[model samples]
Target: MWQHLSSLRARLSLLLVAAGMVGGLILAGVTHWPLPQLLAWLHGGMGQDAAAPTPVTATATTAASVPMSPQDLYVVLAVGLVLLVLAAIWLAGRALDPVSRLLRALEGAVASYRDGDFSFSIAANRRDELGKLIRMHNELGHTLREQRQHLAQRELLLDTVVQNTPVALVLTDASGRVAYANIASRHLFNEGRSLAGLDFAELLAEAPQVLRQAVESGEDALLTVDMDGSDETFHLSQRAFRLQGRPHRLHSFRRMTRELSRQEVATWKRVIRVISHELNNSLAPISSLAHSGAELARRGDVDRLPGVFATIGERARHLHGFIAGYASFAKLPAPRPVAVEWAGFLEGLSLHCRYRLASAAPERAGWFDAAQIEQVLINLIKNAHEAGGPDDEVTLSIHDGGNETRVEVSDRGPGMSETVLAQALLPFYSTKRAGTGLGLALAREIIEAHGGRVLLANREGGGLRVTLLLPTAKAPPRG
Candidate 1:
């Protein structure tokens, strides 16, 4: 029964009943009993000595007919009201004690949640509104705990990936202190020691000269470092970003020596195969033609001898050209940069291979090896013409950007696919059966020698565009 009445509503109802009963008893005493007898009864009921004599033999009608004086009525009424108010206050405090404690618990739980602690939960012992509220708070705590666990797991997985990756990653704060460093970075910079909280500049000061130079440059670069008597190549990249309203920088170093070695081996193998195939094509025919010519000479057939000899000569010339192509690529010389005028250079290039001027030629002179650049343009223009486009549609445009010259050779023809475009600049890689594949590769070698770059892209609608970016002449100079 106590458990059932533990709720605030039940406790309050019982309090109301008790107050009503007390009020009823007081009213009966004041209306039916005389004032003297009433006071005597009140004093006797309170376990105190009666100040007035008790009317033991008095009749019930006489006691009922006695009227209470105004002063006596006021005293009785005042005492009754005071007693009632005290009883109500005591009952209210008893009924609301648990509620005050529950409110304090809720405030404490909220504070815990704000502090990112989700382990605390309120006990839900009753089934009242406050009890239901406690259960909901517990549920909220449970949900928050689950989400926090999932987030923690995700962060751990991310840390594992970053730590185990082969690329060395380092993050530095705006004050040049190391904020984070992965396992690879630790090994690379500190011989497997932790790098956190160290000065980034101090760490770099102890690093290899090549690595120090690359980092100091603040530019993405490929550098080679001699380590344990073996040269290792690494590509370094740096990026700056804001985190938590503060600037930070991330530096990543990826070792590229192994990848480069693999590519070099593959390139050598391809070169050997191409050379063997070209040699067999030329030598096999030449041998057959020589045997045929000898057989005709044995029969005194001189007319066919000349034809066979001419065929052999043509095969020899083709073989010579093929061999020379490889030799030129292998022995590419350093560029001799010189001042070059646009009109004269373009005219000379046009004489070798035709192209329409798509944009007005720039007036400023460019700095590069004119002979080498002319050869590259000739090869490109010839390719544009042979791309199955109309001869007139082979267009060349030159733009004079601030510090560089952009020469674009575009053709309206079927463009190269992604796969083809990717490997087109590689030596001995070609789509045409008769192509030596040295044209584009040699062009790249020459342009790079001139401190320039070659870019290839498909034109918007249909066709290909080859852009050559060359440094412009800052002043007139000779090779």
Candidate 2:
């Protein structure tokens, strides 16, 4: 019965009633305390005489003669009223004690909620309003738990999508600060540090215009960011949206380097097609003219025929050289590697290029091929020598790097420009005055066939450095 009233509303109601009763008692005492004294004084002032007469008169006279004091009467009445009020107050407090306890429990539940503890519950077995309240509290807790679980699942799904998405994705806030970055985005941008809270513009300094436009328009924007110090391209896309009632932007990046490479290859193929058609047309007529001139010369028709033959021969030789260069580009044979002692091969190459090597600085030595490798070395050395001035020197160094061997040919010449370096391996792309540009192209083709890579870079001090890396041959088993 006591526990039935133990609720916030019940406790509040009890407290209000107790306060009102106390206030009313205090007010009544203040107003009525002096009334009894004033009434006694008024009765005394009425001047009624008292005398001892007969038997009835004697009893009245005796009661009148033994007069009661106003102070004593007031004290008696006040003490009785005080005792009654104390008993009522004690009973009321006892009745309200359960309510006070229930209020405390409710307060504890609210405090736990404030502290982020959502698992607390209140017990109520009574069939009253307090029981209904407890049931509601339990229901509220269940709803909160379900909501929390749903939120957690949503976050997990978002994480999985971000990690598995093929395209890179980065999310930022209204202030352009990075909020989240997917795994693909981090890999594509080469971002090692945590992306959260980083300024988007600072991260994408390579292409700030895209970020700026996205922020300004609050919409999706597409742009390209060219990777520095590499032959890679990235396609960037920025999108804006609201998340959890706050505006955010997402930036996506995809590597488009392969696409660009395909486009360059297509362009080269078209150029090759046009050159082949023109060269064939020009070569046919020149070959026929040269044959006719040779016939005239054979008939012993003297002076005019001799001059014509010379002219025909010169034109035919030029055409022949042109055709040969074209054929070399057209017929690039695939590589076939065979094991050979690389050290002895390089030594033979040095001897073969003895004239150029004698003039060059002392060669740096290691291990590489003899015939095929020598061909690559010879081409590079010739190009280096041609590029270097008479007083300038060309240097060749061999490096054995455990798993692979490298041959470096460096020259103290004016370094190649960016355009030249980019297109050096392209057929017919030459910087020389009277040279066929198929040398580097053929050298590259041969090196690639041998499972090697050729790299060209400008030297720090001056000139260019060409590095050739070849895999080392595995040793045979012991006999």
Candidate 3:
């Protein structure tokens, strides 16, 4: 009942009317009622006959009483109630109007928040508590909106960095699941989806131990991993760091294959510089000594001259060949690539050796120049022939790989030692007694210039295998 009464406009109006009615009743009891009763008493006591009623008339002096007829009193009370109700209605509407407007604004604000519109703002023109609350809400919403924008931008920047970094980058979650990988990382790892979700330990099994140390210590780690099924090398850097309050591991990879190649070139240059200096120093004196010996022999001191002259001439010839070999390492010509048929090329190369074909040759060929490829083939074939035992066989084969043409020269001999195999391409570093150490190095330089690679590995059974990979022309015969 109280709840119903509290919600009723009429009840509120009635309460106001009741207050005014109580006040009017008090005034009536104190003024009109008492005075009338007192005048009636006075009239009777002043010798006016009590049996006859005193005549009353409507005048200013008798306006309060005139016996106050019941109908007139009823009309006065009704007028008073009506005036009180009108005042109550006006006062209530005036007091609650701002509240009703504020309630609507609050509803709109909530709806905006629900719809993810943080831009909505409330007006705070009043100096009341409601106004202060609106001001605070606006301030809070502005802060939250700014924070959301900052977080979004930060996320975008991180994504761009991961996608476009030059080094191969891989990100892993706290539990070691691969979460993201960049383009370079995919190409370097060589396994499609290889690093994704794979345990770091498994993915980096071939990596050096430093990588594990870095992860455990929460510091950057550096290690080298040899590419599987290829001769390429990579330098891996691993670091553990936090991203947006979550622990993550990032691995950066750089291909060291080219670095190794550059090192080989530098080492060869150093070797040539030293050998050239020494050979020139030695050859000058030997030539002079040979000339002096000839002069002495012409002057009749023939005995000493013969031994000295023979020694000088022989030493000069040896020094000449040594100098020639060193010069060859320094002066390899640039490759000029052109198309050549594989069958005819091999047949021509075979003319330089007394070799029999073991199988039918490939009909189609690739885009390697004849002169350059011939030099590479002869060096490899000669090495195979020299390395093979008398009864052991040497085989040369050509076949088509998907994007490349491969040429393999195999020799059945005790394969190269690990040390020799590792350093075989180094200039002036040869195992053969007669070798000047420039053959394999020159071959590698030439082939690389032609956009090809040379690989030396041990054959499955018991020999050294030299494989040449050359990029083929587009749209080659599929079969």
The top-ranked prediction according to lDDT is: 1
Please estimate how well model 1 matches the true structure, expressed as its whole-model Cα lDDT: 0.87
TM-score of each: 0.73, 0.41, 0.43
> What residue runs in model 3 are displaced by over 4 Å at the alpha carbon?
1-295, 298-318, 474-479
lDDT scores of the candidates, listed in order:
0.87, 0.67, 0.71
* RMSD of each candidate relative to the true structure: 6.6, 19.3, 21.3
The reply for model 1, stretches above 4 Å from the true place, is 1-110, 118-147, 473-479
Clashes (N, CA, C under 3 Å) per candidate: 0, 1, 0
Q: What 10-residue stretch in candidate 1 is worst by lDDT?
A: 58-67
| Candidate 3 structure quality by residue, lDDT tens digits, 278-372 | 67666777878878887887898887886787777787788777778667656766656667887788778978864445556766666777887
Query: Which candidate ranks first by TM-score, i.e. highest?
Result: 1
lDDT string, candidate 2, 124-216, tens digits = 675556667778887887788788789899999988987888777888888988788877766654454567787877766644454445445
lDDT, candidate 2, equals: 0.67
